[model samples]
Target: MEAATKPKLRVATTSLAGCFGCHMSFLDIDERLFDLVKLVEFDRSPLTDIKHCGPCDIGIIEGGLCNAENVHVLREFRANCKTLIAIGACAVNGGLPAQRNHLSLASILEEVYHAQHGLVDGFIPNDPELPLPLDKVHPIHEVVKVDYFIPGCPPSGDAIWKVLTDLLAGREPELGHGLIHYD
Candidate 1:
């Protein structure tokens, strides 16, 4: 009889508010992705085009919460995945999106839609189809329990690879000085 092979781990990834730089960095894993594929299966990631996340072994999320939709998705993701990792500065501390924290949402919306010189009768969008905006942007931790955090504006591909590899090997991820970077 042939020996049964171990089931591959299921990994999912998502982005919330900030720019998609972190996902770009993840793609920078480049050729090594082939090796990664052997050990894990992608779930609800952009790479898979799967809209809804199923049960997953690990969920990697980037960006901060900016709207009601973001919170809903993050909560759902947290419920579906056993281990959750918050990646990039936005996920860790709200990053560039949290810059609006100092300003009122109403003022910001007015400045963007009403005061801009583009149109004659611009107004803030109030359509129910749109996700309701939050008064302040918030990090993932503020909304859900996060297991691990990979810091950096968008953590380098090498750092991501290290963390994933360590987790896969059942070892605690350790970012040495060389692997930990902000830029």
Candidate 2:
């Protein structure tokens, strides 16, 4: 009789309010992705192109919260994921999107829509179809419990791989000095 193989772990990922740089870095794993697939299956990620997240063993989220939609997604993702990792500076601290926090939303909207040189009928959008913007951007931790954080503008593929491997082995993830980076 053939030995039964263990089921692969299910992992999902999403981006909320920043550039998709972190996901780009994840792609830096390159051909190692083939190896990764042997141990895990992607769920609700760009890899799978699945819109809704089902229950998952791990969820990797990048970017910060900037709107009601983002909050809803984060909460739903948290509920569906057994382990959630917040990756990149944006997910860790609100990153560049949080720069808008220094200014009032009204003023920013006014300047962009009403005061700009464009001569058309400029007004703030009030359509219910639009996701409501938040007063300030927020890190994922502010709105949901996060199991782990990978700190970097976009953490290198090696760092991400290390953390993932450690978790898969049921060990605490530890980054060496060489793997840790801010750029």
RMSD of each: 2.1, 2.2
Off by over 4 Å in 2: 1-4
Backbone N/Cα/C clashes per model: 0, 0
lDDT score for residue 133 of model 1: 97
Q: For candidate 1, write residues 7-83 as lDDT tens digits.
A: 88899999999688999999899999988888889999877789999999999999999999999989989999999
For candidate 1, the per-residue lDDT at 81 reads: 100
Model 2, residue 114: distance off in Å is 2.5
TM-score of 2: 0.93
- For candidate 1, list the clashing residue pairs, or say none: none
